[model samples]
Target: MESYIQISKINDFIFCPRSVYLHTIYDNFHKKSYQRTPQIAGTIAHESIDTGAYSSRKRYLMGKEVYSDELSLCGKIDIYDLQTKTLIERKRKVVKIYDGYKYQLYAQMACMREMGFEIETLKIHSLSDNKSYILDMPNEEEWQKFIDIVERVNNFSVAEAKILADSKKCAQCIYQPLCHPL
Candidate 1:
């Protein structure tokens, strides 16, 4: 059986493919002990959704595990609004809606649509800022870009100094010690 690409990896893969490469090579034991401020904040913000508390009241799907055999992608979506047919992803905060996020949302949409779920809207809610951003549907060309990114990650190779990593992204990366892209 072919292994599925994780939906969570879409952001990391776009941020820096090396992060995903380092992720696959290391075990969860090392990652378990690794916690940064942003990750901690993200976890804290997700508590309600993770425990299905938020969905219970709204009649929504909280932390729903979605998978697509066709796309070979799988991960838990934060919230699926049954009333609105919206696939909503929440973050601790969102200063700017980055491309990585848009791509991640696209991947989620693809997975959900493939799994026979209704998705008419895509949104990202910033928990801290209490803000929400709506994403426009990607054209075929844009969707193709995401597919190409997945292919790159699926066939990823570890090579030092070859990754096109930004200095800002590299500094914030959790895998900096292992990847050392700086």
Candidate 2:
């Protein structure tokens, strides 16, 4: 069986295809004992959002639990609302830096779509300032484009070149040494 996919990994692929390959394909994550402020803050934010004390009828799937065989995609959504039957993907302030979030969100959207869900809405909740932004799904042409992107990711060859771009943020990653060599 293929390993479960994380919706966030889809975004990683979009941000840098090579990064996704390294993280997912090679299973190259290293253990980091140090807890960074951002991760700590994100945990706090997630706690506020995840407790489900605010909303009635809360249902959630995380980590390996969220999956889709048809789309051949899977990922942990921070929170899923069973009441409205929508996917509420949470992001800290940091996600604003990446272009891959769209792909990640779209992958979730695509999976939900495939699961016969009448997704009433797709909201990217920003925990930074406590705000939610609705992502408008594209029209026919754009939908096709997104599908093509998904197909491309699904069919990506092992021979594709891997490039690791330097980022200060890599310091926070346990996989930093493997991804960016000295």
Query: What value of lDDT does candidate 2 attain over all alpha carbons?
Result: 0.61
The prediction achieving the highest TM-score against the true structure is 1
Error of 1 at 50 (Å): 1.9
TM-score of model number 1: 0.89
lDDT of 2 by residue, 57-119 (tens): 336443313567867788655556666766767777745634465566667766766766556
TM for every model, in the order presented, reads: 0.89, 0.70
lDDT of 2 at 107: 74
lDDT of 1 by residue, 54-165 (tens): 7456668888888888778888888888889998899888999888898788888888898888899999999887999998888889889988987776676666325554
Q: After superposing candidate 2 on the true structure, give the runs of residues whose Cα lies further than 4 Å from its correct spot.
A: 1-5, 25-64, 94-99, 164-175
| lDDT, residue 128, candidate 2 | 74
lDDT winner = 1
Q: Candidates' lDDT values, in order?
A: 0.80, 0.61
